[model samples]
Target: MTSASGFLHSLPMRQLRGVGPALAEKLAKLGINTVEDLLFLLPRQYEDRSQITPFGALIPGMTTLAEGEVKLADIALGRRRALLVRLRDHTGGLTLRFYHFRQSQKESYRPGLRVRVFGEVRLGPLGPEMVHPEVEFLSEETASPESGLTATLTPIYPLVDGLTQRRLRELMARALPLLDQTDALVDVLPARSSGGWTLADALRYVHAPPLDSDRRRLLAGEHPAQQRLAFEELVAHQLSLLQRRQRQRQWPAPACTDSAQLSEQFLHQLPFQLTHGQQTVLHEIRHDLQQPTPMLRLVQGDVGSGKTVVAALAACPVLAAGYQVAIMAPTEILAEQHRQRFQSWFEPLGIPVGWLAGKVTGKARQTQLNSIASGECRLVTGTHALFQDSVQFARLGLVIIDEQHRFGVEQRLALTRRGLASGFAPHQLIMTATPIPRTLAMSAYGDLDTSVIQGLPPGRQPIQTVVLPATRRDDLITRIAHHVASGQQVYWVCTLIEDNEQIQAQAAEVAADLLRESLPHLAIGLIHGQLKAADKAAIMAAFASGQIAVLVATTVIEVGVDVPNASLMVIENPERLGLSQLHQLRGRVGRGSAASFCVLLYQTPLSGLGRERLQILRDSQDGFVIAEKDLSLRGPGEVLGTRQTGDISFRMADLLRDQHLLEPARVLAEHLMRDNARLEQALLQRWVAEKDHYATV
Candidate 1:
């Protein structure tokens, strides 16, 4: 109802005075295209420059505002040249060293000129010093007039090249009041939801708090104002995902209720029975499949909890409906495993299985593609190759994605589009072995209904974990020989494929060579990401068939690697990986009824965080518990593998710290969607960028 209501989100950074094209480009690098984005780019910390600290009272390691006359200015010639200017107050003296200075900049700090400085004081070789501190010319003498001090706690923001703190501060000062005059900062949430502060008041407090404001609370983001912003951001994200869910229902999907006979035959052929947990999850998937709308569901279970089996049964319904099914994996090895497993299960029931991947080249690749397009390959499994333009499906009814977080939004859209058969979209059943925390599952997968396999099958023994220093390498190798002599396989996981001094990780090739020399009678195999897909597949097969006594690999083997007889897992530099990754690597073993042990052969001088990560794995075998701890230590990006894998990154709300807001945000999002459509659209416009990706139709 006010002039300012819709302007902030639409206002460009260039609208601010002095922000030219070049300056706006720099801001764009920091994701600041709109005035609202700039406002939300809150300070990492703040400093108090309202009052000055006397040189005598300034202590090393403390940041303070101080002023004094320049005593001496000289160029110091050392290994690195530096311009050093000594300043003196009546009580004490300190030096300002600038390593990067132009001729004009160096000459500006002349002796006898008083200047105000703000920076951390550190004990230097000569005395206390401030390196490259912010320097403002005061006056020629103490008797002359000096500039006034900052009236409020100065906000310190993260910056890009060509953008300085002073420039950003001036822009904020100019633009903030523009919105205030028009009452633009309207509340999308109910009034009083933001810890009793209006959205405008919250932004003002966060951007420029009063001098007496709680510095500790502000620095730690514990203030009510910051919480207000965080809560709104969380709600916006929830609404965007829920909107995505609504769009999924808009697309017509193949309803698959005719799977009972086919699923029974597939189940009967299996040697093992489905665990109660698997059966429960399968029931949920079946109900979703019977819907005409696409099934958006994420199935989660701990490692070796029979998730793939549940997926197989889920596919039966789609297959029975006279349409095809496609299963996608993040890695070729995982995809191959699925292909073989599915062929073994389905080929007996008159269902043909097809495989497609980068490795399936020339005639083989074309044959597989033809089989898929010709309505012959009723079931197919592959890596991202399934998304290729050459690959097409006939009446594709269901799409199952394993390690769903490893694929990007575009890849998802591409595969879902391939199932555009006769005006109907394919149902999607996403699966993940990385146990997602309840709060995270609710937010990240809010677009999809979730069903988690409660626990591992009966009689599954917990993995025995042990932490050992790399100093025990020789002893561990000898133990490895003994383990291998007993006819059991072992996985020697190196963090690298080549020697990296910075990482201090032994390469898989080097480790394999060393292992071969130590145990001449045993067969050793090496695998890494650098290897061709065919080579990697060959090594994995050798290891699986017991031809390779020791399989040396990098973290490429972290996901969906199955080897039942591999009772021992020796991870080099286990400290380098997060708890979830380490847990996934551990899951590779302890897979069989035989007892399993995971040895964390960590290099010494491990950091506290690294040590804590290793300890968490050593103490507990629960993937969910380990994943929650990983989220806290590493944040959600790395936990979901999205930092390197996908576009699902959050701008403000941290899943670990603001988890308490998730359920409330979910509730509010649903209410807003039902009660007010205009507000829901506004919320999505403000927060989300990839709405097209969410529109799987």
Candidate 2:
């Protein structure tokens, strides 16, 4: 019970006896550069060799230990040549085949030799057999099957080709004793934090559970030792965020103040009234902007909840304070959409809206860059190009990131660094249509004050969602024609751009062609990722202006494309997508007073999970609810996106699985940062070290 002492010191793997440069390099390949890292590298599974299973008791698909005397050893010539050895115990005989083996290994497997083997049992050519089983020779004194059985469980680690399981175990054997002798590996957690187990005891127990250990519990990562370690890792992750969050607030940011004269004027100039949800979010952002410290707030709103309107409104205070506002979008389409919306709202008010994107090049790009830097353009909206080194902002104030998940931490930090170049960190506000559940938001980050923009805009009709089989798709065409006759447009969304050889879903172009044939009178348009950005924009523009009666497109239309006249949406093969995404696609409709409909045209014989996902979408209009369900179906990493969770690669903790630990981790992180100044830094260093990912400016 002394495998890992603690995080008091990060002893380099090279420092371990017998670990030379080559060995250390091999260890590094598996990310085990330090003794602490090696200890943290818990086995994915363990082999129970305490009691050898008899050949008769061996079941197919069971990984177990067995011992017998080799009765026959010869090369089996067939479609695939293999060295097959038959071993017979007192109960029965089992076959062990090796497709890849040395001649020496073949010679060693002589008939009448007593041997022990460990591997998974699977039905093979000669009944139940093990492929390339681990074999051990039993000498005359240890010929009994029970004599060679290991007293404790054998740990199986994730390893490279050169680093065998036995070698890794030997390394652990050497490291565990050091834990008891050295004072370096100190337990970072408080006495009460790690249940009743110290860090070293937990590590030791995890790495080498006794013969009586609950094998199932340890493999499932349900053991108390495992949970304690998961909790500690999660707390360390929170501590990292807490450190970054504190460092971020230390820098001064321009306080745009309550000079909402322009914001109010902009709101008054709008034809439509802001919903209560929009107002609430706007109020939160306004309050954040007025603070001296940089505002790192994440605003969550469902599609059609009017987040862009809120973003535009948030930017007004920065403009009124004579500071620039830069809005970053994920794609050119989204960025252009923001630019057009911002221009319409601000250009009339004499504030120039600058645009920068990957396509904007050479002199024209420089001209716009100059305008931004000269402070002539008070508002700028673009994709990642906005954070490029060449794109300098003149007194930048508020930096609003749209669809926050699309951008990673590096981009966030790049923009933060950009703001610092202007003498003060910019008040940052990020918006995402994927409304995060309260639990997810808290677990994902201890930073980023969240503002939930709930409810649709005043005139938005809750889209009536329906689930229908693909067999009824033809009937949908007629219904679409009738809907078009009534002056409403339709959107037919495809999951793919072109016909895929494997998947049966219709492609965007193929669906558009078929729709044109089905409704010869209706104008059909196609849009997808493969199309040029300008062409996609033009097609979207046509659809928006009602020139295209039916827009057959891929999932690229999931966000930033809003057309109030387009009411009916048919998502083809809706089962292939996540529920949250289906909600976003449906958000493209229901933007206006017209009663909207979303038809989930699914393939026949839907799987249970696919059916569940579709039904969840059909029932719930709340993005948060759908997101929570999505989070349940797909873990936190998939729901939150890898970009955001890249730095939060938990060694053991799963946000969804160990959600109970999130609040405790958050609370402990706060306490550690407040009370124990010295140990807090050490704890952070042990778990977080050089990996400093900033989520806030």
Candidate 3:
């Protein structure tokens, strides 16, 4: 492999001309694998140490450098494992305390020895004291650099376990000069014809600022280098999405001429008219289905926006073409709900429907698989089990994934590959009930054609959201009982599954026992994550069918469980949940034409971030608008759940704060791929090599 000149291909810290193995291990812990990595490791913070003050002028609780002689050295144990040492200069004396120290190391200090201590000093009963101060030995012949100094500032960096600020400074000094010798790479950014410093100069100036004024100028957006780096990251990301989209569009799809006819038939049989948003999105889906090439589209809609109906419409074309369609949901409960709803809708049209899940067993599982393989099943719905080796479709034409955010790129690719293995690649339609912010949608889903269902179904009432402190538990239960007495169903969502169950069971048992004393007619059922699938299903069924008046549950009911009769949702300790989660929980209500109410009971003394989260929800009902606010309030990493995989990984460019970087980055990415293929290939190879090294480590 070719190596860039002046840039060390590898730098052993021990062989870096000055460092040793002990220091090398310390540097390695901080990811300083080579001279290049060390060069790029920026300082976390800077402290000005150029000004040194006299002992008389030193203030307690301020970091200052003091040069003094060790006037007295003795091991005097205090209350705990404490050792005290006294140091004095011509002006004053300061006591240095060590809480836990080895006797041998303490004995190394000698009286009259001069040293420079850099750390914070605090006022003690005696005068001023410094505990375990950072001390550096000095020579008697050499006057202390910190002696009688007025002012000084030093740069501090994030240190690893054994690394020190001094070691890091030395490493940077060795590497920074090498960066100057390396010729600036071909500038991918357009020149600032409007009159400013070039990108190369900006980078150089930022790296080695001439003065404190220059450092501030570089950091204050006056330098073009920061902008250039941000733009490069954005463009690289946008280009990747565009390329993937282009590749997807090239796949051939089975011709489905009967899509419109089948879609019309399905719509005519619906119980209610479609919302305008639903209609608009359905029109978009029909256009994609009628196209000669495969369709890769994303249907983004808020909770309870009738997205399932739009998905049902998209599947019509495949069923009408005599090809099978498969829709995958994230969980078994959601899969069952889709299967039941779709089965009822398609049963009238003589289209066979089948369901596959982890629960399917014996002849039932075999029957479903056989029907799907033989082309007898027109629409198949399931969870991740649909991708199992045992599951096969005769002529899968359309693939619709519900809750697309929960599935990674590899899972989506696996699903697409399954459809293609049968001959023709199926048209892909991804649906997300979690409304993505506009900026996020553009960056995250730029590759797919997007359709937004912005409105809810007609006759659905808006849920009344109310925030209540958890201290008013008794009053809240009284209100809940009144709702139950009126024949309305109530859902009490708990935060945890097991621990919450125990807490809820105690709360419920206490509440039920109290209610039994007054009114013994109401039935209270408890459901949590620990329950068996069948038991959970039974509990949910009882609540939906009105067999139980009030059901206490975990957040499992946040997704696809629909009950029109349930009108009350009481979330205990709402602050414990995220903004998105609370929004989803509230969505469980207001599904019916009846007026619904959601009470968010939060704990006292809420954290600043937590209070802001709940306040945003109380102020708005629009999920997309709330999502944008959430992104702004919390960073992209928290909003996207850092644990999420695939293309979501980003190092420094945040989708929220750095939104300005996106469009320009996208344009540059396309230009590089189209106009500069060699550079694009080199970047891709470098990215993969770095990823591999990271994974190995």
Q: Which is the leading candidate under TM-score?
A: 2
Computed on alpha carbons, the lDDT of every model, listed in order, comes to 0.83, 0.83, 0.72
| Candidate 3 lDDT over residue span 289-405, tens digit each | 887788889998888999888899888877888788899998776787888889899988888678888888899999999998888887899988888878777888999999877
Q: What tens digits encode model 2's per-residue C-alpha lDDT throughout 331-416?
A: 78788888888888898888878899988889999899899888888888998898789977778888899988888778888888
Q: Residue 411 CA error for candidate 2 (Å)?
A: 1.0
Q: What is the C-alpha RMSD of each candidate to the true structure, in Å?
A: 3.1, 3.1, 5.0
- At residue 390, what lDDT does model 2 achieve? 90
Window of ten residues with lowest summed lDDT in model 2: 497-506
Error of 3 at 324 (Å): 3.8
Comparison by TM-score, 1 against 2, better one: 2
Kindly report which residue stretches of model 3 are placed more than 4 angstroms away from their true locations once superposed: 1-143, 146-168, 182-184, 193-225, 249-257, 291-294, 361-378, 387-395, 423-425, 496-520, 606-612, 645-649, 679-697
Per-residue accuracy of model 1 over 1-697 as CA lDDT, tens digit each = 4323367777888887888899999999988898877777777678888888888887899999888899888899999999999999888888999999987887888888889889999998878799999988874354343356778899999888878898889888887786575546556876656677877887888889999888888777778888877888788888877777888788888888963899889878888878889989988899999989999899999988989989999988888889899999999888988888898899889998899988899988888898999889989999989999888887889889999888876777887888774578899989999999888777767788899998887756688999999999999999999998887889999884234533322466788889999989999888877778888888888899999999988887888888888999999988777789889898999777778889999998888978888888988988999998988888877787762224455655667778888888888888988998777777777666665765663
After superposition, the stretches of candidate 2 with alpha carbons farther than 4 Å from their true spots are 1-10, 14-17, 70-93, 99-113, 137-143, 181-184, 496-506, 693-697
